[model samples]
Target: MRTILILSMLFCSIGPANAAKTKKPKSEEQKTLYAIGADIAEQIINQFLFEEKERPYVMKGFQDRLAEGKLDIEVKDYRGKIRQMIVDRQQALRNKFLDEATAREGAKRFPTGLIFTETLKGTGEKPTLKDKVRVHYHGTLTNGQVFDSSVARNAPAEFRVDGVIACWKQGIPLMAVGGKAELICPSGIAYGKAGRPGKIPPYATLVFQVELLAIIK
Candidate 1:
């Protein structure tokens, strides 16, 4: 029933020109415009569908605004609301995961909310913040969704320890060359409020399986 309502609202939102009486695109320019329109519509649909169970209330609010005609909707207001929702959800999941992870025998948590678990121990010296290091890493959200991976690229990444996120600033220094460790970073030490947009959502906790290769000043 809710799905039907969502589809109905989507069709209605397409406007009268897109209704049954509309003519099909006839030229290249017309076709491009039609495609762009479809893309925009798809984005909107996907946004609502991301949280479909909560979308009915959102759609009802939108409908009320549309009916009022003169209602002023502030973009900042809605954006902030959405950001806060994402932050709250992400933080809750992060806390729960950290609790479970730190309960494991070998897992350790830092004072700054960074969680580290060693996979391989190394005998070489650890890198300092002033030194650049080459490493391979696979990064994911707390929900086990991979966001980025140097391992997947089959190339090691080189960067100064301090140049990366706050979590890496502290955690990487603890890892010696040839060591492999898993680092769980809280949002405050990761992307924080302004996440990597489409790649990482707001207030997302990041988990990285990092292998330290070489350190160079």
Candidate 2:
């Protein structure tokens, strides 16, 4: 019954009638409804594609199940299973990347699971966790997708060391002003299980090329 209701709602909201009139100019009410439908569709696509590398296959499986009327499983149980699969895949990728990063020469691992390599040595004082500092950074996922970069913005970022992720709090103190380093962070020390939505995925390991500019007193 639930499956039927969901299918009915989907069909009523976005069916052949709507698709057939795509080239025509819509009234304000029709435009508003169309925007809402598009937004919902985009969110669903992004959620499925975010952690599922084989999203096309997953979507195909979903469509087949829906078409065949195989809705015996409860919705909550199905969602739980999918979530577990995504978590397992994420952990596998994170471990593989960490292994490769740690095997590199010149890389040093801290007891807290933060790994770093100094690219440029500095002679100035190092900032404490409580002290605010300015730095330029390029941050990426283990898969090399850059999620954030102060260098790209042509500006240095300033914040207290303790205010950032656990990895930054522990790794930044190892560098003095003007020093540059690359930090490889474990998920526990980075965003952990709940990453920044739409930017970083859950259980993601992060890599950062950071240049310390000032201790900011």
- Counting clashing residue pairs in each candidate, in order, gives 0, 0
Task: List pairs with backbone clashes in candidate 2.
Answer: none
Estimate the TM-score for candidate 2.
0.67
Name the runs in model 2 displaced over 4 angstroms.
1-79
The pairs that clash in candidate 1 are none
lDDT tens digits, residues 167-205, model 1? 999999999999999999988899997999889977778
TM-score, candidate number 1: 0.64
Please list the residue runs of candidate 1 whose C-alpha ends up more than 4 Å from where it truly belongs after superposition.
1-87
- Candidate 2 lDDT by residue in tens digits, 90-181: 57666777778788988998788888999999789999999999999999987688999999999999999999999999889999988999
How well does model 2 score by local distance difference test? 0.78
Top candidate by lDDT = 1
lDDT per model vs. reference: 0.80, 0.78
